[model samples]
Target: MTTEDTSIEQNDDELFEHHAFTVDKGQAPLRIDKYLMNRIENATRNKIQTAAKGGSIYVNDTPVKQNYKVKPFDQIRVLFEHPPYEYLLTPENIPLDIVYEDDELLVLNKPAGMVVHPGHGNYSGTLINALVYHFENLPNNSSERPGLVHRIDKDTSGLLVVAKTEESMTHLSKQFFDKTSEREYIAIVWGNVTEDEGTIEGHIGRHPKNRLQNTVFEGDDIDKGKAAITHYKVIERLGYVTLVSCKLETGRTHQIRVHMKHIGHTLFNDERYGGDRILKGTTFSKYKQFVENCFRVLPRQALHAKTLGFKHPKTGKQLSFDSPVPDDMQQCIEKWRHYAKHQDAK
Candidate 1:
């Protein structure tokens, strides 16, 4: 059986997906776009050509144009900053940590490292695949993402709700759109936030240079981005890191991460936003080694989607759910507590 190699990579705030395929011996020469269309589900010619123009398409490990012909036994690869929409979704029996389930909707805690839905290089083993396999006739709002009202990042563990019917999907979506739903996140960020409570207001949009990241914009240019607001309160104080609870007013892509970074407290271990490095702390070798050990314990961003509240679509009753911080993050926090106490003694 032929196997395709796929990897998702991020570098210097740039996101890229890598896909490699080997052509069959009997394959005939064909335009690269056409060839990809036949091989990659839901890939349109325009999208393929755009990627080619962006230097994201490759053949035999070399960049190629959309018209580059594919020959028999040739190696084909493609790289893109974003995952294209997936056309086909196959259900898989992946276990889910379902928090609550009713006829109208179901709430579940999404673990870290599990994609909320399939896209780009992630075609399977997603929450959507598991939901489809476990339930019947979940609603899709004219999109591939079925029953989703909103989405959290794949690496951020959290609570999410999925609609079981169209009415529920519409109602829940409207609630999110109107900003009536309540969502709270627990995050550990570098640097001790000076304020006990504060609100972060910014116009958030894609970074001008890095397509993989979002940034805060202001003044006339602020009109180019969406308005985003995050209200945060200090939860705990570690020596070099502060734990904060963030509540969203307007949900934009990476809103919390961007807003926090704009305020000079990047989420701990959030490599995409430059938090993985030693942003705050002394340059001593022992301090550096301690930070490295903490990084090893928590490999992803120190954020958790801890609480969600919304009115039920069917019953008009309020519903809420909460999830504890996962083990990795908890352990990392404990280590920091010990280190901070040790430092205070010196």
Candidate 2:
């Protein structure tokens, strides 16, 4: 048993949390750095690599590097610098839409327009806040962010998983590594897709000149991006806009929206990517009215996480959940469909 040592006190700036976690097969045999990347939410491989090289990572009491292989039963220690908020604020109750719940995990249908967590310039109304509030007794992914196993965009409503226990979080996260997790989304695009089904395979990376946009390039470096694959089927073609079911082959930030835009079909009302043409409502009254009335151009990308499936981390049970499109998106589709039909009749 380790003895308490509060005699050595640290200042606010000096007190970084040291996390201890066990390695299971979900983490075994992979490069120690990537394994750490797999185990932690939002922590990347580069972060782990830097920590290992800087002696902030220890496996069984020895500092290791990227080459170290994780093994079951190994006690991994990570000394990561937690921001000042870690110890200062406990997670508070924020209302959340719970889709499914078990002892090990909880699946939430996060509404569009809720930030996943509090970050720079954002101090309130985030998914993590809700997780913390709801799972008040549950441990966090680390000491800072509470319970989040994965995320969806603030304005993209869909299924998200929060781990109730550390072991479950670790195991479920590896499914993402093995590409076994089932993630499906629904998106409304600006143009109709003639093809009933198709796949867009592109190398997606940061924009060359426009830092905010994602670009698909053919060059070898391709900016060293992950090969992003999106399998999409036209679910409903409303003459102008279309509802598409998107199955993610690889998960990336802003993936579906960017990939669709790359294929000349940005999401309906994506001001950032589609610019003028998609947004200009010369005569679509319902859309124009919405823009001019209650909601402005501020609606989020019309993407929804309709389904997510994965094996239970502790029990290995195949778990799946599905949700209908939200009311706003439903109204958008119906209004667009009516306008398209009227235009066609003319």
Candidate 3:
């Protein structure tokens, strides 16, 4: 898998950029920070040094200090947290599924594969770019993602609320920060969960070995990452896979995905978390073919933002919205239901 962690959404306010380079065989030995500054535009030696100190710079898969020399054929990779690209916010007329619209706010169902905002490789055709073209005078936060109070993963389909005015933005953001906003997600994960309802409580942080994915941290290392909590209830059992609903108390990066995987039930088809293969079920040829078909039908993670509830930013009235699962997920679930039924008969 080619690092789909870039597609995962995080709670951080800053956007991160990842870059990689291969040193030439005849390359001259130089300080890694100096070499990176020469290749990357707008890069300062201080910024590169900071990234190295932060453990975001790697030389040949090993974290190296800024003063480390670049050797011939050395593979260099760097991940840097940068402010959103201010100059890249051009209005593009990409279509949006606007479910509700008002002067102060707009609620929309974002489809899978459409990034919420411009970041790194995705500069155009984002929800923010569409909002900028469709609406006027949206509030611009510190980052370039204008009016976005929260975000869903790029491969997770679901509902999102965008603030239209500064007052609404502040009010809505406070609701999310306070954990008062109601957000529910529906997911299909590999294996049958024995628990009817359970809560996953742990600290979530970036993986120590692979910075691409999030891992649950336990023991006395409480300060390593922010506290995250997810409550889940099994909705249905479909032999190899189970449908479940998750409610998040803390919206950390990849919270649901990471928590579910921690319990040995990775999300169905979530390639980034090792759910794309046959995590469960028999190894018969027919079963293997059936799973391959399911993967084909649902190419992305089998998760969706189903419902959202919060107080009205201006009116002080409670508001809520719900969406049906997308067609692809619906169809995949039905296929599993049929397979499970047939397996029972046999």
Best by TM-score: 3
Judge candidate 1 at residue 104 and give its lDDT.
90
246-310 per-residue lDDT for model 3 (tens digits): 99998999999999999999999999899998999997999899999999999999999999999
lDDT (Cα, tens digit) per residue for candidate 2, span 221-324: 67546788999998888766788999998887788988888877888766557632444346766666644431343266788999999999988889999999
Superposition TM-score, candidate 2 onto the true structure: 0.70
How accurate locally, in lDDT, is each candidate?
Answer: 0.85, 0.72, 0.86
Lowest summed lDDT across 10 adjacent residues in model 2 is found at 1-10
Error of 2 at 168 (Å): 0.5
Candidate 1, residue 163: Cα displacement in angstroms equals 0.3
- How would you order the candidates by lDDT, starting with the best? 3, 1, 2
- In candidate 1, position 332 carries an lDDT of 92
The digit string of per-residue lDDT tens for model 1 on 290-342 reads: 99999999999998999999999977889888889999999998999998889
Task: Note the residue pairs that clash in candidate 1.
Answer: none
- Candidate 1 root-mean-square deviation in Å: 10.7
TM-score of candidate 1 relative to the true fold: 0.78
Local distance difference test, candidate 1: 0.85
lDDT score, residue 195, model 1? 97
* Per-residue lDDT value at 127 in model 1: 91
